[model samples]
Target: MPTPLTPPSAPHWPAPVARTAVDATVALPGSKSMTNRALVLGALASAPVRVVRPLRSRDTDLMADALRALGTGVAEDGSDWLVTPGPLTGPARVDVGLAGTVMRFLPTVAALAAGEVAVDGDPRARERPMGPIITALRELGAEVDDGGRGALPFTVRGRGLVDGGPVTIDASGSSQLVSGLLLAAPRFAKGVEVRHEGPPVPSTPHLAMTVRMLREAGAGVETGENVWRVAPGPLLGGERIIEPDLSNAAQFLGAALVTGGRVTVPGWPDDTVQPGDALRGLLAAMGADVSLGPDGLTVRGSGTFPGVFQGLEADLHEVGELTPVLAALAALAATPSRLTGIAHLRGHETDRLAALVTEINALGGDVRELPDGLEIRPRPLHGGVFHTYDDHRMVMAAAVLGLAVPGVEVENPETVGKTLPDFTGLWTDLVRTA
Candidate 1:
């Protein structure tokens, strides 16, 4: 009966509306997983590491605690963290908050420890998946016990993993699986050889970013298209400057594109591998002017807004998490949009496709649900009360619909705290500029 919320203060924008002429530039938050992964890498390496612009979020904080539990010298120096790698031993407890990354990644981080670590998190975190990590860890000689059948509140008894050479992980379900195991390989007894086979991998680019960052930290990693191999070695301490999240920028881009305005997001990584950058192309296809710059990226709106002139069959398997927002766009597009390759959305914080259809349809959009994705036809949505289905993306996506169309009230905006805690403030700032 408990549901996450946006907030009462944020305006309830209605559908079948449009953004008034507006223009503004905004800054983005740092990547939560990337910072935590970098910190973990720093802890597993033999040198001191610094993370520039690290995010102060629940997820990252949990990772820091987990890293510290592993005997890593973790200290904060302003926005930077000074981490010294040492021989890490597991602790009696590891709590990962509500982070999917921490739950998945810490299981492997525990494999490198020498004692029994009972890992758990908040109530919602208990509902998330942990099977892939448990299966992989067991195969690699880790004694892991889940809630009962490899679930949470489980214990991973580590005797220091022997190099489990050439492991194959079906990470298509969650790219975090790939990032989790790959980063933990260097600490394995025999190092790790990971072969990833799944439907089409979700968030391949973010997984690739994990691989790339590991190598930068001094781990030997070879990612030959599909397969990834990591050699056992310490990640050397170094400084990694994490850029503002491009993923978060995609939402604002949606905001500007929906409204008749130019929204510039500063400090985005131009050459970054984050797949959220794919939003640039997705929005452009719908008739938005998006540009990348040295300091950031900008989205100039199209008042005409051809509205997803491209065909509706979008392969969102790589960046499927964006389906909720994209679904809203599809609802307002010239033709129906069918998003495929994301059955995994059902397993997220909420059943996203269902949430998309239920909330959007309630708002008067012609949205329908499919087994794996959705088929949405262009329709004028009448803003009313939009339920966010306890999902942060759902809350924000409904908010996006508000920018162009007025009268849509997003229920429980606080759910945005899962990632962008600054949502209300950011919207206020943008509204002020407009």
Candidate 2:
């Protein structure tokens, strides 16, 4: 197993409480989703490429390192990454940490290499769903040795090329399985056609994002009901500027609703496939004034204690990653909330539904775990410790709760380094401005 990134002795951080309405403009880092996808596409390109404003986090760093281990050149220039594609060869070992993207996405890239690539990750990572992708690889004409465990600690004994064709997989667990195959498909001898065969695949926005990036990189792609086709072709190499991670912007925006303050995030794209963009509608449903213009997305809360927001009922299937912060907001809302359509969350960094229910209830809230989602009924809350379970979003959720309920200590706040390395600092500044 890869060395655990979080030490058992990691200190807990006391989530800062907001004393007044916060009015601040927070600038966020680049998207981890985009950064990793860009890196993979760049490494498969016909020439060198530049990924501008890429996220500098553990997950993205692991992606860059994984590509480098497979003989790609990933050099840093200021805040950007310049990738030079080389012959894909490996006798390499990849430590995926706790990053789902690195574990699921890198294996396909490794399948294009000429030698053996051993892939493993942190202890919890071994428990995540990897069977679909592994099975898909074998069906697509690559050799994956999982020893029948169908999980991590696998080896891809690459023959330097995959004879890609139509293959079926049940991507209900995660969309990364589809993206992992699609991102590396352009390099396959015959490209690839992927068809989903089980329950509805979650996170459709992420799937769309993958397709968009592939096309932008010059690969011919087609999509239908439940299938994706990538034509065999050379990917163009050039500069690709990454957008600010709207998903990571969730907590900052949620803070506005919690404190009845105003928070603006700059560079909110006019058009994008990021699921985080759904926050505008979701927050509005819970009673927040939201606007987007040249100044970017701005959210203003009801400037009153307990703010004039009601509980929200929505299906988060396409935007499941937003559940943590949204759940925290639900616990503070004036009415009860029910968030559904995200059963796949059970496979995330932690069993998020259970974790949210347990942590919030520990703080004296009423959150019940549903089979598919959570039903949160607001209750008077008090200060207590909120365990992160090595999940970054869990830390984000705790921070949102602390704005109203004092003494919310988050275990292993450093786990936020998975995506947003400076989350605590940014959150502190936002609260301090209040």
Candidate 3:
């Protein structure tokens, strides 16, 4: 085998290995998806809305700043955000950063503003897919200037009212396309009817989340086969509470499964449309005992040393965000694993499928890249420098590997700030307490 990789070229973080089975109660930050959705709906609400326990991270901060740029007031009232609607005027610049939600969701909001709003982001943000949203916007009667490129670094000229009605597009690459339109539909002159006509929309649960949140905010939404209708109406935003980010919770729970330890994530919702909730079944199938109670959800190892659970045969299309952690677990499983239905991951913050394969194989693991997914043959993983590619999920996945493998360094460890600013510190505490 190739020699273990030395430290990376730049600042690297040493991932700590677990000395014992981790037994910690982790309280995660609020959901990024729900926080941004609340921000959008709160901005469009007829009255000031208070979002309780919202996540404060780079992605959510960007969303709040974008709304503030559009003449809304987003102030911190304790851990909540009190969003007061204002005249949607702009001549403002919206820094989308690397946030897919901000980049995809804000343009439609800006279309309802009076002046011009410039939307741009990190260099990688410009390369991400934005054509679907842009095309649908123009069809809905909005003036968007993109300098001939369908991607970001564009400007949306707002006439203060979108003439929304019917539009069709392929939303296979990302679910943000449909969610973005529905979010801005309430402010449109005629509401919106979106028809997704491509490969099954990846992350359908996220779509359901959007629909559920919309209806909860008093908007009329009708869902059909690959179709969604949002009626033009006033959004009644009062006080809304955000659930903990179950996606991020995957990292902590994965730790318990790997160490043959126990972990409880307090405040797990009894009912949620969050895609990460799929972990309950997925982890149980892999031999971890998962239970949901009044306090939250708990996962314990199957009395097997090192928690060598059965390999996974899962389709992670709707929960593609969990692939990195699952891929990491597959690398350490006792049997071979096959994960499918996540080809859409190529369009995420990075080409995740490609990145996972390259980094895992570099660490002395056997992982094959498929056209749509991965086939992992568990093997001994040696310590090495695992590159994160600035993707937050990639960073968390590497940390999971470090639990069993020694001396694994994660490049660009700070990248976890994208979604979970306190990820490293929280992870350290979990390992230390264990």
Best by lDDT: 2
Local accuracy of candidate 1 as per-residue lDDT tens digits, 50-131: 8888876667778888888878777889877787877778666889876788988888878778888889887766667667
Instruction: List the pairs of residues colliding in candidate 2.
Output: none
lDDT of 3 by residue, 1-434 (tens): 12112235668889989987888999999999999999999999999999999999999999999999999999999989999988899899999998999999999999999999999998778988899999999999999999989999999999999999999999998999899999989889999999999789999999999999999999999999999999999999699899999999998998888998888999999999999999999999888999999879999986554776888999999999999999999898899999999999888888898889999999999999898999999999999889887789999999999999998989888889999999999999999856
| Alpha carbon deviation, residue 80, candidate 3 (Å) | 0.6
Per-residue lDDT of 1-434 in model 2, one digit per residue for the tens? 12224566777899998888999999999999999999999999999999999999999999999999999999999989999999999899999998988998999999999999999998889999999999999998999999999998999999999999999999999999999999999999999999998899999999999999999999999999999999999999999899999999999999889989899999999999999999999999999999999999999999875466889999999999999999999999999999999899988998888888889999999999898999999999999888888899999999999999889988899889999999999999999988
Leading candidate by TM-score: 2
For lDDT, candidate 1 versus 3, the one ahead is 3
Return the lDDT, model 2, position 84: 98
Every model's TM-score: 0.90, 0.98, 0.97
TM-score of 1: 0.90
- Model 1 misplaced stretches (Cα beyond 4 Å): 1-19, 304-312
lDDT of 3 at 334: 90
Query: Ranking by lDDT, best first?
Result: 2, 3, 1
Ranking by TM-score: 2, 3, 1
CA lDDT, every prediction?
A: 0.75, 0.94, 0.92
Task: Show model 3 residue runs off by greater than 4 Å.
Answer: 1-9
- The better candidate by lDDT, 1 or 2, is 2
